[model samples]
Target chain A: MKINTTNYEEYFLLYIDNELSTEQKTAVENFIEANPSYQKEFELLKQTFLTPEHIEFEDKVLLYRLEDMEAKLPSTFKQSLYRNEAKVIEGYFNTTLKRSIASVAAIVILIFGYNLMPTTGKQNIQNQLANNTGLPIIKNESSVSVSANSTQNRIAQNEVPKIAQNNTKPSKTLPSIAAEKADNTPPVVINESIANSAGQHVNNENEMRASPSANNTTVITAVNEKITSNETSIVAEAKEAFENINTDNPDRTIYIANMEIDGDKLRGFTRRIGAFIKRNKTEKEK
Target chain B: MTDKDFNNCVDAYSDGVYRFIVKNLGHEADAQDIVQSAFEKLWVNRAKVETEKAKSYLFTIAYHQMIDHIRKDKRNNTTDNFEEVKSNVNISANGELKQILLKAINELNPTQKSLVLLKDYEGYSYQEIGEIMDLSESQVKVYLHRARLILKEKLVHLEKMRA
Candidate 1:
């Protein structure tokens, strides 16, 4: 704590290096002045401070990575920098062409999905009757032994009377807490099926059509308004286009871009065009 | 760190590092090599190092490389202490205190020289000098104080002999 003859060097070093606080520095100053003999030693210690030399590193260029940093355009990707009217128009046309092709492909897929998907009401009821194991087989006098393959036909003949008479017992009343669990499964929208069957109602017997192999599920029928106006318009356009292209003879082969050709060869030419467009599209993607 | 950050490091700390090395090693080419090696190491490890710590990081690297260079040179060749320096550089009766101080600093061991350089030249605190030289803070203070005393003794000895 005291700066004296013995411990004074450490205090002097701290003072010269500016490590001492103001109070300690003042104390050190007083101590040095009190003993003039130590003043010369402090002065020599102060002289030990090394003056900085200004030596510039000349080849700092070697340390720089000029090749690593390329002048990059900002992230906004300034589209205006690429201004070209003809290219823009070409891009628009290309996008429209791709959309048209996509629309045609979607229509073809929908047609296939529609054909494979929905069950007619009578057919689904027959399937349900054949599948529901809880319902014992009614081998009445009107029927004999039923094989697995003809189970649907046998169910149709026997179950028709019970179902058509509206004698299907209502679903058993479950606990009040779980009363709605009967419909807990997602609602199965039979809108497209009902739409296609016209007058025959697949919506009515939806609950009764649970095949035995199908999981124990309650079918809820709800009308779906999923088709948008754009989709309807695309379908209509596809229909109009289809009708125009499909004709009985060359005279009736609706205008092929105003070029007349044998109707037979038109199919092959269209196929080739489709193949070429598909090939070019895949190449561009790559 | 990005390339831009690394280049900024080179621009900012290269001169300080080069100056420290050259003054201690007393050879421009070897000091340049040591400084270049430090920068190259910083470049490789830029990602792990923060930009805020770049100056200390550079100094730490250059200090060690300079030490290694000195060690290798000591092994391969003989070295001269302050007496040899005094024998060679005779001023007309101790003319320049600056020359005497410079020669005296060069006479210090590598660690002592680095302690003085980081302390006075770079204005580093005792703690910071310790980090650069891998010494403890207390050790840095003791060693640096010892080095300054040696420099002072040299100056006083030379002046007395000449006087």
Candidate 2:
């Protein structure tokens, strides 16, 4: 039987590999024998399939080198969860866990402190009002006390005697007195005290006492005048106090400096805490 | 694949991978690096690669890495010329045929050299070669046949020279 040479390349490969049956092989052989010019090409095609020489090396050495290469590979991938287990645990404790713990602690302390502290300014004003009404009068320098009612009665009845005792040197003005008071008093007292002292200029002490509203206006005008007159003296006293303050006490200096710095830091810290609380509250509301 | 299976894969496939790369690249150091990198990639993606398919996976990786190395070395002017590589092969006294074949193999392009090595040296089927080479089976067969023809022609020419 005649075989087609046109598509014989595939059959030729199968024939060379001995994949064809005996009859097919015989037919391919008959075809090749008949085609004399195709003989050299067929032999070359067979030679091409001949296994090429491999680089010779000791099998033991190659295997050993391959084992060495295997040893160099990482046991696991870098991004694999198994590989990064320790780091993830460490990072949780170091960053996320610690930060959350600290935040919770700060918020707790802020809320507790806020609940304990007084909320309104009215409490301080009420304390001053109580002192003005009937409390014991504490002398500024000596800390000696007299009843407020008695002090007022004595000032009303024996004003001349008190003036004589001081040899008519006008008493230190209210601004100076107010400046010396360690606990900050309201400015209203400064106006009232200065107006009372100006009673001599009006020559009408009973009239000053008669109408409270008129007395308040007169006190305001008198306080303004006193403030203008005493501005230079107040500045001079301030400069003297600043200059004469003893620098020998290092502990006191450090304490005062620390107090000033701590005051500013405390204010800033409180402001931040307040803002944080406000934000959380707003978020809760939303 | 579990770590143990991956390790088993390394033991099973490392030598074959090394031989394939070394034969293709003609540089033992680069072959070692490519082989290790291939195993490392297998370990990285072991979750995605089935244990049975690890051998193919490794060879595929090593083949691509070898190609990349060739391209990179080409750009860097570090690729060894065919003559330079031919001169470096240590031919035994009676190994003229081996020397001629090595020289002939070196003359083929990098891809053809790789195809011939995978098919003949590693005993991979045309389909396996195609999978590793990212070519169709027919394409692999054609390329392998063309590569073998070149080698045979060179070998015949050498034999004629000797005669």
Candidate 3:
């Protein structure tokens, strides 16, 4: 009753589990049915591993329970489908489109109104019209009103006619007046004085009213002086910060020192390391 | 298909797919999420999935999604407390056997594990496993054989331990 290793090992488990193909199954069945010892071994292996005890769910109750549990299990697909459902836009499409068109129209109107500034300076108006229409100012429509107002104001003054007559009388006194004004104005106010030389002496003072920088000159000068002083102190502070920056031995990655080491000092420290090691050896020998 | 048709398919297959996912994933929340994601994919691609093929398609999605979750989670252990195994003594021997079965299943590589599960749990034939896994029938057989051998080995080990 010697069972060959290959046959016993191959068919023993397969025979137990009833997993052999039909022909092989028949062969194993016939063999086991004849031999009680081999049959016992086959049954032991099968019952031990394949018995319902190992897999408790082979019965109808367990199968029914699985069905019941499956029945109770929620449909995840439906939940996901509900979650990803396309959002419904509830209102009428025509209404939404119409509202959007109206909004665009209002934005266009506001942009046009904002560009039509009555009091914008000539240069500012030129820049705005260039920016708005993305066109170079061939003749900026925004500046025409300001120019007309200036011309009308000039006509009302009767000052230009007088200035023309005075121009005929005043070549000798003109330079003297200009020289006196230039000498009296500070370097800080030189730009304002340059603007004042444009029309009549009276007109010169009137044009001075239009100088953009004139009113802010005092405030700008105080700010400039303060900034200059602060700049010198900042340079000094920066120099101190640069000087105080520590450069450790790159290999060591860190160093603690009370005093700062400059580039030259760092080189010196690196060179000293080898000599220092030698010195330590000599001292240890002593 | 209409939303109603889609809903019907969902009703038919959700629980089965969910049970399969729960068994594979072994966690209630992870299984639920994977099941939900699988359904979302079906809903999004409802036009592509037909009613006849809906159950298999749903399971295909759930299986892939479960694998993806497992890959991301990196939890290698496969022994999940039979959330389905409620009362202990009713199937005492069956519980140990089931654990050994799952342990054998868990020892399989992903493709093998999937093939065996589809065959044993879902009752799919070799051709069906091939269709789901995008393998040839011969390839499925090879992997199934390897998986069965591993299961048999584990079963043998369990028997020896019992002895």
Candidate 4:
């Protein structure tokens, strides 16, 4: 019954909970009454214990529903782990893996397509020459010979004789022709008589005539001097002649004789011609 | 524990976990998700967790998850206006003292609110709460005492206003 002043709170809580004996409760009540200020403190402590507990029935229902859902959830832990692994694989395929595969395919196609392009372009140029000239286009190792038919013979007389022939080796390939075109080199003219003979046999005969052993060596020397001296004028005249060719003239089969240009060089030449035509057309429009 | 034992743990401890989380967060959806995730973590380490200590393991996982969520919520400012929302709820009705007490409980910081819930609603001892919350028993006791005093003061003030 001797409630210590420092331990008053301990007794007060016990008194409110009815844990203290009847005598102890009476003594605690007397202590509070003696100190009137302690009465309000005691009442507040009692009210703290009197606070109501809030039970949310709706929350209980929701928890029960959640429990039901969790109970029905798949219990195969390993399978769930495997499903996550499968998701990783699927994600890789959707992103990085798919992009890598597509990139590889694109690179392969580009390389193969680039390699095949030159041969296809050569065939197209050959076909176009055959169609226009109506001459059987003879493809040699380093020369494309279009035999001057009756109509081309007249055009050949005027163009081929003015420019002198050179006894240069007959090793002119298409790539060399592209190099020449790139350098803007002067065009070389073959003899008009050989051009009129047009074929593999005539090319061989001309090769023999231009050889060092030939009896026409003086004629060949004189022709080479004229070609070297008049190169610039011949190039200009040839370019002008090419520009004046009436492409719309149905009767004219323009035979561009053995200018042994390869597919790539031919394509380059065609591109330059196309650009020239485009520039003229644009200029006229303006 | 086997898969069957883990399932049994889920049935046994899920409701307590949900109640503990929901009371602390006051977000039913987040509480359900946290409870489910805690059980999943237990199931992952079921071979290591003893059947008898499964409840403790589950509660520990949920407590850490709640701490992470609170930290994330703080970063996102999701709970910034919580006090404004609490102030708007009218708690002056004669029979609505329960609501007022809950609102006051919500006003506590996440740590204090969690301690109050584990101790009162889940009936966890200070030592058990310390193990779940990763605090020492003495720290749990001190924090729990402070939380109770705050709740007491709030309840007293509200009661006076009603009178």
Predicted complexes: DockQ each: 0.34, 0.23, 0.07, 0.11
Candidate 4 clashing pairs?
Answer: A174-A262
lDDT (tens digit, per residue) of candidate 1 on B1-163: 7788889988888988887877777777787788888888988788899999989999998888878877888898855434543453222333388777887888788889888888777888988888888999999999989998899999899989999
lDDT of each: 0.61, 0.56, 0.50, 0.56
Which structure is stronger by lDDT: 1 or 3? 1
Model 2 segments more than 4 A misplaced: A1-3, A13-39, A50-286, B2-4, B79-95
Best candidate per TM-score, number? 1
DockQ of model 1, rounded to 2 decimals? 0.34
lDDT leader = 1
lDDT of 4 by residue, A73-166 (tens): 4658746766433443332245465456556445444544554554455445434543533112223313444422321332333322111111
Tell the DockQ for candidate 4.
0.11
- What's candidate 3's i-RMS value? 9.4
Stretches of model 3 off by over 4 angstroms after superposition: A1-286, B1-5, B75-95
lDDT of 4 at B31: 71
What CAPRI-style quality would you assign to candidate 2? acceptable
Model 3 pairs in collision: A53-B93, A53-B94, A54-B93, A54-B94, A54-B97, A56-B94, A77-B39
Q: Candidate 4 docking: what grade? A: incorrect
Candidate 4 per-residue C-alpha lDDT over B1-163 given as tens digits, one digit per residue, 9 for 90 to 100 = 8766776666667777876776676666677788877877876677799999989898999999988987888798785444543453332335565567677878888888887777666667778889999999878866766666677799888888878
For candidate 3, give the lDDT of residue B62: 81
Candidate 1 chain A has its poorest 10 consecutive residues by lDDT at: A172-181
Per-model TM-score versus the true fold: 0.48, 0.44, 0.37, 0.40
**Candidate 3: deviation at residue A245, Å?**
77
Worst 10 residues of 3 chain B by lDDT: B85-94
